[model samples]
Target: MSTNSRWWFADLVLVVGLASFSGSIALTGLDGPLRVAFVLPLVLFLPGYAFISAIFPEAGNDDTRKFGSDKSEAIYAVGGPERVGLSVTVSVAIVPLVAAIANFTPWGIRVLPIVIGVLGFTVLSALGAFVRRWRVPANQRYSIGLPKLLFNSVGRHSNGSTTMVNIGIVISLLLVTSSVGFAVLSQPTGQQFTEFYVEGQNINSNTNTFYQSNLGDNGITVNVGNREGEQTQYTVIAVLERVENGSVTEQNRFDQQQVTVQSRQTKQVTLNGNPSLSGDNVRVRLLLYKGDPSGSPYRVIRLWLSS
Candidate 1:
C-alpha cells in the first residue's frame, strides 16, 4: 500500500507480535536467554518508539525550524538520531511508569499486569501514530524503508558522514542493549546456603496445626532445600525435649538420617519415632547439619505441644 500506511501498519504488527511472544514466554514459565531476548525490546525500546512515533508522525526535514512570521515555528518530525535516541530514553521511562501505575491497581505491579499495561499502551500509541501519519499529505508524510536504507548505506557509499554517524548510533544502542542483557542473564557467584525447615503434611504446610497426643503419634516432615549451587550432603537429627519452667529438664535423641540433595532441589526426611514424652511443654526439635552432626546444628526448627 502507501508508504505511510506500510510504515505504521508494520510498526503496529511488530509491536503486537513482540508483545504476544514475550507475554507467552513469561506466562508459560519459560525462561533463559530466549525470554530475555524477546522481553528486553518491549521493556527498552518498542513502547517508547511507539510513543515517539505518535507524537511525531511526519518525517524529519533537514531544517528543524520553519521561518514565516517574526516567530520561528518548530517542526513536528524529529531527525533519525533524535527519534531513535528519544525512543530508547522514553522507553526506559515508560516501563517504570507503567509498573508504578500498575502497583496501585488490583494486580499490584505483577508480571501479568505490567505486560498487559505496556502492550495496551504500545498498541494504542501505534494506532494513533498510524492515523496521524495517514492524515498528512502523501508527499509530506514521513516514511522510510528501514531495510533498504540500512542496506544502501552499508552496501554502497551514498551519504558519507551522515551514514557513518547513523551507523555509529545504531552500534552504540546495540552495545547498550547487549550490555544490559548480559548483566541480567549472567549468573554471578553469590552467598551459598541451604534452606532447612520442618512442616506437617506437604512441603510448606503449616507446622502449627500439627499436634500429637504423644511424641510418637505424629511424624515430622523435614525439608532440606539445597542452594549451595551443587549437590550437598546433609544430616538431620530429631531431638525430643521435656521443658518445664522455661527449661529443658530432659532431652533424648530420637532419630537421625542422612540425605543428599541436588542444587535447587528439596529433599524431605520423615522422622516417625520418638520416646514417650512426659512434661508440661514437650518440644520436638529437628536440627540440620551441613555434613556431619558432631558439631552444633546449622539450622533448627521446633514443634511445641502442650500436654
Candidate 2:
C-alpha cells in the first residue's frame, strides 16, 4: 500500500490519523476508541516525526546512508551538528508544554481541543521543516542522518548487526497500539444517575412531627452522582406536598437548586425544613432532571416523612 519505501511510515501514520479522526465523529457510539487511537499518535509520535523530518528531510538518499562502512560508519541519530540535538530537545518539550497551557484555559483539558492543538502544531512544524529541507543542496542535505533512523530504519539496514534494534521498534509500536485499543473498549457509555439517595441527618422526630430548623437543614440531604454521558445543566426540586381526599398538591417547596454538572460529576443539594411542612399528611418528593423539570427525570426519590 506504500510507494516510498524510505518514507512510507510517515505516510501511513498520517493516513491512519485522518481515518481515526473521521471515525470518531461519524461512527456514533464507537467514537471513543477510534479517538484514543488517533490521539496517542498525535500527542506522542506525530509531532516528533515532523520535527525529525524538518531536521533531516534531505538525508534519506541511500548514498549518504552507505557513505563509508566499517568503522567509518553511518551515524544513527547523532550524525548532525550540535543544533540538531538542541532542536530535538525543544521539539520534544513543546507539545507537553502546550498541553499544560491548554489546561489553564476555559476548554479545561478536553480531548477535542488538545488533539486539535497538538496536531496543528505538528503540521506547522513539519511544513517549516519541509521548506528548510528543500532549500539545501541535495549533496549538503545528505549530512542529516536521523531521517534514516526514524521512518525506514529496517529497510535501510544492509547488514545483520542492527536486526535486533529494528525488531525492538516494531514490538514497541505494537504494544502502544494495543494499549489504545484497550482504552477505547473499556470507556463507559450512556447516561443516568450513578447514585441518588437522601439522608435526613438533622431530623428530629417528636410524636409524628418531623422538623428541623438548623443552620443548614432540618430536612433530607440529597446526594447525586451524575454519570449522565454529557456535560449538562440539571435542576433538583424537592416539594413537600399535601394529599387531601386522595388528591395531591404542592405545599412547601424546599430545594429549587439548579447546577450545571459535567459527566461523572458528583453533587450534593439539600431540601431544608424551611418552614417545616406539617398537618397530618405530607410527603417529600425530589426529582433530578437533565435540562429542566419539564422533561423526563433521570431520577426520582419520594419519602413520606409524615403520612
Candidate with maximal lDDT: 1
Clashes of 2: 0
List all candidate RMSDs to the true structure: 6.6, 10.5
Candidate 1: tens digits of C-alpha lDDT, residues 61-117? 324445555232335556556667788889889989999999999889788888888
At residue 98, give the lDDT of candidate 1: 92
TM-scores of the candidates are 0.63, 0.48
Give per-residue CA lDDT, model 2, range 205-248, as digits (tens).
Answer: 33423433342344466777766555668788887778778788
Cα lDDT listed for each candidate: 0.72, 0.56
Q: State the local distance difference test value for candidate 1.
A: 0.72
